[model samples]
Target: MKITIAYIEEPPFGWTGRDQAAMGADIELADVVLRAIGVSTIHHHLTSFDELLPGIQEGRWDMNVPLFVTPERAQRVAFSVPVWSIGDGFLLHCGNPKVLTSYEAVAARSDARLGIIAGQVQFESAKSAGVLDRQIVLFKDQPDAISALRAGMIDAYASTAVGNRVLAESADNAALEAVAHNNGGDGRVPIGAFSFNKSNHDLIKAVNKRLIEYLGSADHRARMERYGLTHTEIDGAIISQSAKY
Candidate 1:
């Protein structure tokens, strides 16, 4: 059987490596789990963050792995058990002058403008933190949002913690710094999972069963460390009640 997986180039989760190879913890996990279930071939479809769900819904792919499992998303796709738990992070100008570390901090500042990728979970987290719609500037992707921050168009670029770390450490972003949680409320950790087209229940069930076993194994930890994920990040993993099969 063949399985087509849709993914975006979000560091630590999904990205093309130096040799133009598809890589990242999520991809490896998907490969292992699918192959265990008799999937003879695996094809990865590189897509934009905005395209993940729509691609699945449109039958462009069999699954979208490693996306945050939001209730809104669950309505459109069948999400498997949580594969990882993630929190919000920010890419801020050097020195973090205002000491802005969380979404609550940004919300408290009337002059603050936050750059967020359109359709990302961080957008909703910002809103939940009392950030006004006007204060939240939506961008098409993380790079664009980070550019706006460097140009002073926005105070900070909001995204996943590991993602922001990758951005801050990249050669082009040496002037920026990363912080762990932007939501300010105990890390706004949300469970992430593989998204299957709603009609693919059989595939979803099989993947979920294997995923749970994989996540609890030492192999997953090895993958996490190899991908630059921190110990806290691994420990932060949580199961989502809504995502359980």
Candidate 2:
């Protein structure tokens, strides 16, 4: 009858607002879906990105805010149907003097350094694109990475294209900008969904049922739009989920 969800301070997805209440697209989505599934009470626990999976597996929370679904992660937790599909991008100082548009571009320049949150998929993406270990800097969270980018410690900060855009706009500084990755031939975007302890089959099933009926609804789209998500992201998830499930 009650569910506690873990979330990180990732804007446009989840964050603690001015009022100290959890807010963002993913938090709202979780609230709506969980409530509809008959959860009488809901709790939001703020945690670091690295802690989300282990915390859930330890029974510290019942669910997590949407995160990218990876094969390795699927082995540890059960994910709800995809909620959004998004591509990666970079947060850079305004003017982008280094011309860093993609991971490959950064790799090509020995002087270019990229910042990524520790444990994020971006690290692997950067490595696969030939970025050397010395060219990469890892941070514990988004704020730290953004700080490094602003301070000239890192040439670019890699994260979701949508999240970087929102962060750039909210920064209220003319010195920050976001550039979508040039996926080139691949053109594939990663999909994200709520994750739960693998053993909690009943909870996952109920939430997935409600999520299926709610994800692409008019109300859902409108709510998400307030948090900077568009049909491009929302509809993509619906389409991807349809094919997979």
Candidate 2: residue 20 lDDT (0-100): 86
Show the colliding residue pairs in model 2: none
Q: Residue 198 in candidate 1 has what lDDT?
A: 92
Q: Against the true structure, what is each candidate's TM-score?
A: 0.89, 0.98
* Best of the candidates, lDDT: 2
Output candidate 1 Cα RMSD.
2.5
lDDT tens string, model 2, 155-228? 99999999999988974546899999866686578999999999999999999999999999999999999988
lDDT of 1 by residue, 41-111 (tens): 99988888899888989999899978888788989988887777777788899899767788888889988
Clashes of each: 1, 0
Clashes of 2: 0
Give the least accurate 10-residue stretch of model 2, judged by summed lDDT.
166-175
Cα displacement (angstroms), candidate 2, residue 133, comes to 0.6
What is residue 35's positional error in candidate 2, in angstroms? 0.9
* Model 1 lDDT-worst window of ten: 236-245
